[model samples]
Target: MSASQAPSQPVPPSWKDLGKAASDILGKDYPIHGSTLEVKTHTPSGVTFRVFGLHDNKSSAITGDLEASWFDRKKGISLTQAWSTANVLRNQIELQNHLAKGLKFELISTLVPEKQAKNALLATTYKAPGLHIRNFVDVFKGPLLTSDAVVGRDGLLLGAETAYDAREKKVARYNLALGFYAPDYAVALHALGNLTTYSASYYHRVNADVEASARATYDSKASSNVNLEVGTKTYLDNAAFVKAKVNNSGILALGYAQALRPGVKATFGLALDTLKLSSGSADASAHKIGASLTFEA
Candidate 1:
């Protein structure tokens, strides 16, 4: 039977099946299409491509985007490009390239307003083989929308990342991240001129089918409130998945994802505002529902 004729919302699948592959390439920032739907394709030549059709609430006029990504395994590099007519073709073009191994570099360019665009480059050096410690240098040019525009030697961002793995302990793992966006180490030490952000996360694997994590974020520029989040992911039977999370603001969210058919998948998400619910306001905006479908070729 065709996917459209199949049940749109079925009973929750068992939490033990995990056999689906994701096609959206821009990480978690990609849009989720509604009834209008989205489609993706992967080729034997290591190319991943996807198209999205965004429709209005009434399913009227449609607008959307096309994205394609490919990797050159031998060269250890990958490239991705996305374009959409929704932004006048000028502000819709984005290109990104990344190198996977030692002396890694990532460059991203995106069109912006004001007849300008921004380009940023990030370079990383691994401290040692099989070690998690690494150093990063970031530089930006063009418009300031994508950067802090600090320039010169002072504008550069110096960062490092390290992690602790505890899989052998059958317990949990911890991580720490640090970043200094100052021109000099002295400025970073002063902690007054250059901006900085720090984050940490703890992750635990409950079993082959479930995992849980908690994360915290601290921004030197905004020290009043540190952001925190706790979340869990579960793999369901019949190729289904579910994720749920709660943030510091008392916002709770749940999402269900499933592969309805071969090369086809769908996701539904709902979020609730605990504060609003506690206030006894019957506003429907306090609760939200979203769903998207995708077909892979």
Candidate 2:
């Protein structure tokens, strides 16, 4: 006799399962994507060639200046593509070195990053317990002696990161963090809290450089939809610039990063950037701000 129906058992889903689902969902849309380069010249066909460069795994922020040059043997003038190629290489190099101490070295070439349709979060984890650092620059975890995976129980995330100036001196201060979410607590204890709930387990970082750090940031949802971060950072040694000399270094930062959709974001940031020397001989600073729209990965 044919069975009327096949046996089916309902499977139990645990916190781990839920966490995995969350991670998978979030990891698909990371904020850090590749950069763009634009240069203007006199000629329409002035563009000789373009090199889609990648991080040489040696620099950070700026590309390495290696193949940083393009030849314009015909017109004896460098074209737009040539200039762009230079910046790309330089930017790649800079990014690699800056993140050297961090674990973003692999960020240079990754099918995951190129796959714009899918958000990419590292699937690796710390075989042993470990800590990580976070930074505003690259969109990846730091040199994780321990890895930070997508999902976990108790909902605690631990990480840290740092930033450097053009002179290769560490300037910005970063602290590893722990994010905790007690879903049960939210449901049983509180009712007005069903948001993408997350709270810092802890945030701490100390800057040893000569410059003082003055910075603050607020990331909240209901009571405070404010995203305010400002701080000052100085250098320990006197750093020099082209046609300019300075004895001090400091940065006043302000930014707001918020969610635009379930897995998307809109970001805006501005900073007062400067390099000052102790001798009071040189001073330099610039006003900078940028906007970025991203997916939550």
Which model scores highest in TM-score? 1
Candidate 1 per-residue C-alpha lDDT over 162-254 given as tens digits, one digit per residue, 9 for 90 to 100: 222233323122222222222111112112112265554444556788766665667877686778877777889868878887888887777
Q: Give stretches of model 1 more than 4 Å off.
A: 1-37, 44-47, 53-63, 70-79, 86-108, 111-128, 131-198, 218-226, 278-280
Off by over 4 Å in 2: 1-126, 129-248, 274-285
lDDT of candidate 2 over 1-297, digit per residue (tens): 345564432222222222232232222222222232222222244332232333321233445222232334443323121223332211221122232332332222222233342212222212222233222333343322222222223344333323444343434333333334342211111111222233211111234432111112233454454222222222323331011111123544343445545545554444444543345654433444444453322
List per-prediction Cα lDDT, in the order shown.
0.50, 0.30
lDDT, model 1, position 153: 24
TM-score of each: 0.55, 0.22
CA shift of 209, model 2, Å: 28
Residue 44's lDDT within candidate 1 is 97
RMSD of 1: 16.2
Instruction: For model 2, state the Cα shift of residue 63 in Å.
Output: 10
